[model samples]
Target chain A: MTMRSPLSRVRGLGSAHSGTEHFLTQRMTAIANVPLVLFFVYLLVTLAGRSHAAVSATLSNSTTAIFLLAAILSVVIHMRIGMQIIIEDYVHHDGLKMSLMMANTFFSIAIGLCAGFAILKLNFGL
Target chain B: MAEIRTRNPRPLSPHLQVYRLTMTMAMSILHRITGAALYFGTILFVWWLFAAATSRGFEALNSFFDTWFGQLMLFGYSWALIHHMLGGIRHLVWDTGRGLGPAEREFSAWATMVGSISLTVMVWILGLTLRG
Candidate 1:
């Protein structure tokens, strides 16, 4: 077997590879976002002009609740993946890039969690 | 006699004209632009949500979103959101190292643009249909 270049093997290790990983994740998330987004659009269109109670009632439906949760989760993950790539590419400060990536992950998670909880609470009337 | 000679070698890799542009490339660029737009656009969503949650009757929110300018903003935001999502998928396929050739790349690009626009138009049509 022909030997690979040292750079070829090492190029993707650690920080360098993280960018590629992020890119892959971005694409993965995009594929995931497709169905989730379509469902979300349908959900939103249905929710248009709905009363608060009616909206809550719809969310309370197990199917609706699940759909909403899935949509939010996929979207938040997708956003995090996209932003991570942007930061890795543009941010030169090593410390700042790491810090911002961590912060972005946390924020996206929090938003997803809160949004999920809100939907659940509304649906369950708890 | 003193003479100076200089050999300007041809430029390095990635000559723009040599490689035909692909749909994947176009989509890749759109993905970035849409992502950036969505990043900023989230602020609008935050503002609208805050207005609805904190203020009375949703009038403040309604007034803002119901205005011509508000509709335009919303339209732009929706387009960005949809476009970015489609472009992101195109990127994902590229990342897998499967769709880099000329034909597939162009196909994905046109698909992203056409898909995004079609979805936008469909949604708008649905909105109009619902209203009537």
Candidate 2:
């Protein structure tokens, strides 16, 4: 009942087997981002013109911390996947593309960790 | 695998330069550009978080963000974020197997551009007014 080519089936491959997962996760993150990003903008507006202590205090709230962390995680993953697609399409060189893909993943992870750690530290008043 | 070589230069597919510009095409490119911009812009978010966490150098960072140049950069970043966001929504709509008609596609493109700018302006206005 499969539509895949016989050769593809024999090779146990099907058009970049992970494409659907990538596409779905991208969309899922996009949906999650809609509300989370709105909340983020609201946080920014609330923080505007405030003192450092005031800003930190606002971020220290558990709800605020949770939302911020979630947004950061989703945004980073979504960004990495998006960039990977662009790199795949435009970078034809196998070596260069693989390097860039690795860099992109590492960069996203680094950003996520740094941002998440900062949020947690602030939340704990450390 | 046997080594293979082409006697002639490989035929390359037509790229951006080969096509005439259109609104949808431009917006599609801009969506990717703005998405990339947001990737870089996340550094600003991280800086803010780090400043908040350390409770040191926060004022200096705040002052820098308050300056005209910093404000301009923030404005650009906000616009890019908003634009990419609306572009994402447009993409989601397309994913649902809807809005693929040529007219709907063009309308969505225009809406994404205008809506992002308007939303950014509204947020900025609210921020300024609330500060007063």
Candidate number of the best lDDT: 2
The A-chain TM-scores of all the candidates are 0.77, 0.87
Lowest lDDT block of 10, candidate 2 chain A: A8-17
Clash statistics: count for each candidate = 3, 0
Tens digits of per-residue lDDT, candidate 1, B1-132, equal: 112335975564665477777656567767788886776554554443333333345455566656888767766767777887777666666667998888887787898899898888788779668757
DockQ, candidate 2, comes to: 0.49
Candidate 2: true interface contacts recovered: 0.58
> Model 2, range B1-132, lDDT digits (tens) per residue?
112368987877789998999989989999999998889889888988898899778998888888998788878887887899899999988888999999999999999988999999999899778767
TM-score of chain B of 1: 0.73
For model 2, name the residue pairs that clash.
none
Interface RMSD of 1: 9.0
Q: State the lDDT of candidate 1 residue by residue for A51-103, as single tens digits.
A: 54454566668887787687677777777877877886678677888899999
Model 2, residue B108: distance off in Å is 1.0
Per-residue alpha-carbon lDDT of candidate 2 for residues A1-126, written as tens digits (9 for 90 to 100):
899886765563344577889989999999999999888887877686579878988899999999999999899989999999899878877789889999999999999999999999988766
